[model samples]
Target chain A: MIFTRSTLMVLLLTVTFGVSFALLSPIFTDAQLEQKTFVTHSGRVIETSGEVLDPVYTVSTVDFDPDEFLRNFEYGRISISDNGQTIRDYTIIAEDDKVQEISPGVFFNVWTFNGTVPGPTIRATEGDLVRIHFINNGSKSHTMHFHGIHPAEMDGVFEIVGGNGGQFTYEFEAGPVGVHPYHCHVMPLEEHIVHGLYGVFIVDPKEGRPPADELVMVLNGFDTDFDTENNFYAANTIPFYYQHHPIQINTDQLIRIYVVNMVEFDPINNFHLHGNLYQYYPTGTDLVPSFYTDMITLSQTERGIMEFQYDYPGKYLFHAHKVEFSEKGWVGLFLVKDNSTSEAYYGN
Target chain B: METSEKTSRIKVVTSGIIPFVFVVLMVAYIFGPGADLLDLGVPLPELTIEKIAFEKSEIHVTVRNTGPLPVQVVMADVNDRIHPAAIEPDKFLNRYETALVRIPFEWNEAEPYTIGLTTDDGTRFERNIDAAAPALQMNFEFVVFFAIIGTYVGIIPVMIGLLWLPFIKKISKSKYHFFLALTVGLLLFLGIDSIEEAFDVSLENLGGSFNDVLLIATTVVLSFLGLYYVSEKLTGRADSLRISKPVVIGLMIAIGIGLHNFGEGLAIGAAVGLGSIAFSTFLIVGFALHNTTEGLAIAAPMSRGKLMIGKLITMGIIAGAPAIFGAWVGGFAFSPFSSVVFLSIGAGAIFQVIVIILKWIREEGDKNLSSAAVAAGFATGMFVMYATSILI
Candidate 1:
């Protein structure tokens, strides 16, 4: 009886201490976290002057032969800096496309980008001109199709003929700011896009990104059949590089994220964040400050923008909701910084 | 290890009409003037970990899965200082995602410094990351804290229930089975959803090992579970069937689970290779679900074994060991082909389970059947999705 009473008392005391300690934990104050400036302006990526095609090797990054020059390149992205400020990563081909370096999966009998068979997240904002100048380097025919947004002539559906070595200027007057996915809508789409050929198109909010910081991300997949590093996924694929990017944030500040699904065709894209939630625009429209959550599901050819404020700051993580996706490689991260009010509390 | 054992000793009885107490508490807390103080909420932590990086060095950290269920992870402070942050990514980091949160500090001059590592659940875990001395890689392992969570969800409920339930009214066999079913259901749901949810990653434009490996790995895990379920059902129950080698069959099931988890590990490896700590987490969760169910599956059969404790522990390993291995692999030396092998294996397991359920249904179509109940359950699940979707 004495032992039992002592044990109960000890347990009660411990719990009390723990609960009080937990409750007393200070809330993140502005002085504790790091805040960045949200700067949004116009960016133009045009070959109008025809000075340099940027002479980029439009091929799958997995197939990007560093030792050997990009000769008859199968696929890749056009690394044209948007206004020379940011590299507007754009997919260009298929076949030679790739998945992760560790698990290299290649989809044959298809045409797609270099990284993901479906390609990466292609982001843009409302009123932004989504202009594509393709040189048609594939064997057969191919065209671009905007699944999320609409276009009268060059929606790039199967109707257009993109034969061998042919090129076309695919342009879309940016529609309502939202997330839109574009894919290769040629014959046997399952094969064309399955191999590699797609990207994400994120149309920003009509006004602009939320007042919080802005992080535009492009997620996709690849198919590099021979690498042995990535050969699990047959069609859709997320590249190794995106997975290579780390997501870090400040705990005491607000954040706005633009996440778009660019894989030409595949898997339910469930984007989730750890330890934190976000206010999102479903169907990629109408953002209310209260739509806060940690997970957001994106269907094929979909886009979403998440915004939220951080009151508690600590180490946080973000990634795909799919358990195995990370193993195969679709993942990213964000780090939170210590945003404390003053050192007086902890004596730091 | 400890939490699972503790949860088994739970019992709940409510002679005091606990619901009334709950109502009173609710009224007192919600309607009372000091509601916030009396409620279950407490002040959230103020220290935010953001843009915390080895601004002058490279940091390598690994978060492990040590929980009964999967939990989400986000950006941790210490090694973060990015211009913009992706905090609360609309997704979760599964069980064992590890990341090298490197700031890529190119040292033009030598300086003394340290790196910080953070876990997603506000667990401020850090490592003294140093990179100047021949690129020394600092490794940090995650603490699952599964035992802690289990204590609250399982043992606490059982203890409270036991307090009110008549001491003479020990739990009945059927009640135990019902509880088992509930646990199974929860685990199964967690397993399937976690695998699906964990692997279903969608990045804008950049796709490769991350999505492909993860997708295939997760699908395989799902199929393995399915096949195993089906196979067990087809093999018949322990009562009437005289299997030539029951032990072999059980071992084979265990092996199949192991193989599938290995693939999940590969996915984790690939994610980590690309510096993705979040996706690794989901892989861990999927593996945990896979492991826990395995434990229950074996435990049900070995209910009467010499040293029941030993057998249960062994069974838990049979189911859970693979996950731990996979987590290590994913966090270390995982690959994609493993995902394929595991996917096929998991497919087999799932088929086994499905087969079992199908045969049972066919044999007892009307006996003890509750069509309304099943339909209601299905409707309820669908309604939740619909409601959430609508609200969003």
Candidate 2:
């Protein structure tokens, strides 16, 4: 085909502009308008149902179940010592940069022992030699400080272990049979404690107590905004988690709860049970009951063992007596089921 | 020969060792101390609420993840009360990802409400609406309200400025070119003003990633070239009995001024929609005064041509009515990117019209480029615009 120079120039310009425009159009267009499917870190392609908004909210498949935490206890590896003494060896790894979702949508940098806030509960019998092989994989220095009796050198406060793969062995006799708190005893203790560095330590007597449905409840608070005051309070790490997923228990069975108060920046926290009273041991130091009450106030790290039985199958509420704390998520419900009947009764 | 054989064997053994050593070193570099040394702390999540649309018994929130980490919207809360929300696409958002969260909430109008979203990491992001109101809909009342505002801001003001046509027609032939030069000066100011407004809007409302400067520049160039092409086609038909060259330039001036007024209307409507600025009689008066000078610019080019009342009125409407459409869109769905685009186009159109006016002035046999009367008229045109703008 014969063409003038101007016509040839126009054709060349048209092709160039068309190709460039086609390539550059996507840059100016809204990305949210396109429906895109993304593969998650676990290699799962997620499909969504229902009307999606202009920009879809990313829902997480990862869930933190508090049910397992309620009844979990770490007794450690058991063995006999050289001198015929019972020895319990435990490996507690301290990490300072672990990010945990303490509640829906809230992620906090929690310094953890064994990778969990209000770390694992360490249980041991009286006079058993407790050997904790501590590894600090965190960015900051840490130490295992037990609230029970130990040698001066064994105290975690003085011998500050260095950070980034620092190691320390804490060998101590589990004395004064009671419920105590084991936490990071690094200087500026509140900073360590508030970021979830503490856990429960239960030392039974030479002879164990009566068999019961035992559970651990660690009272803690998160200062999300770092304002020195807690924004949310909870039994475990997640706020209102237990309230949404009520703890199931059987009626007419003895229920023992190892309650520990580890909330910092607050003077005291109290627990109140609805429609129930129980025999409370002040520190579980003695087998005898200290008091019978529906509510009990505790200071920081104060702990006790409560033994009770519900005769009727129903839902009961348990929460902090402090209105502010309870209102801000320190609440839960216990769903007591009748063991005699096959049908479950769920109470609102 | 024995030495040569030994050397070959050594070379073979060294080649084998070299690869093995390299493999071990690569593995160590990737996964050993090197990995541990490069360990950066946990990625932080940031959520930004882009827009909130209040519907009947529903609040639709547009949220974007502006951080490096992926975030999941696990829960929604209205005034601290948990409400089940249906999130579109998925609740998990990668960095720079957007999500639409539709929450069924019974919100009272005029009452303040706080909407909170909780991510999987327990971070609560909250947005507060000081006064709750339904999003603007294309209803009868909405159309009438915008029309009234547009009429005051665009149409009436331009018609008032066109009252200068009789005075312009009575001037001597020697002084006639002065008015055309003045029209150029007025358009030049309007063109610069439109560009400045476009840039301001882009800077304030558009995100950094949009590259608003490039977008505005591209739109201006495209609009200028487009108008120039259309004017060239009109010039080809100037010999016909229907439209003349002067009339075409006059029409171009009206179209350019119309576009500029539309942008102005958008600003006013958006301010009212956001409740940032109140709609008052004083504001209307200020805007009317500011826009009257636009009509004078449009009429100046056609002063020497044959006058027709119908043509004049048509040009006036062409120059004015787009403000109504602008008001409607701005009051309902005010998007910053689109605003920047339209303002740039207006600036481009104005500049194109100015070029045609200058060319016509030179064609009229005014060989001297800078005459005293022409310079005085141009300065007067700029001064008039500045004086009117102070009221706004």
- Which lDDT tens digits does candidate 2 get at residues B1-392? 99999999999999989999999998989787689765779766677665677887678777767667777876666675455566775687776566777776677877888887767665667778777767877789988999998988889988988888899899875577777777777778888888998988776555455567787787777778777766766776777747877788888889888998888888777766755454434456677787787888777777767887788888888888888888887888776657887898899898888878777777773566477767877787787777766676
TM-score of 2: 0.72
- Say which candidate scores most in TM-score: 2
Off by over 4 Å in 1: A1-125, A128-130, A148-150, A218-245, A262-267, A339-348, B1-392
Instruction: For residues A1-348, write the lDDT of model 1, one tens digit per residue.
Output: 857855765575466445434422322222213332211111222211101101011112444321121011111233444653222334354333322232221223435454433444455556555566655666677777775555667767645655556666666555666666667788776556545566555565556653555555545443332222222221123222333333445666667665665443455767777776787876566655436678777666566777765666554556666644443345544545555642211100
Deviation of model 1 at A49, angstroms: 56
| lDDT digits (tens) for residues A72-153 of candidate 2 | 8888999998898889999999999977767655678889999888888999999999999999998899999999899999
TM-score of chain A of 1: 0.57
How far residue B269's Cα lies from its native spot in candidate 2, in Å, is: 3.9
Score candidate 2 by lDDT: 0.78
- Candidate 2 second chain TM: 0.75
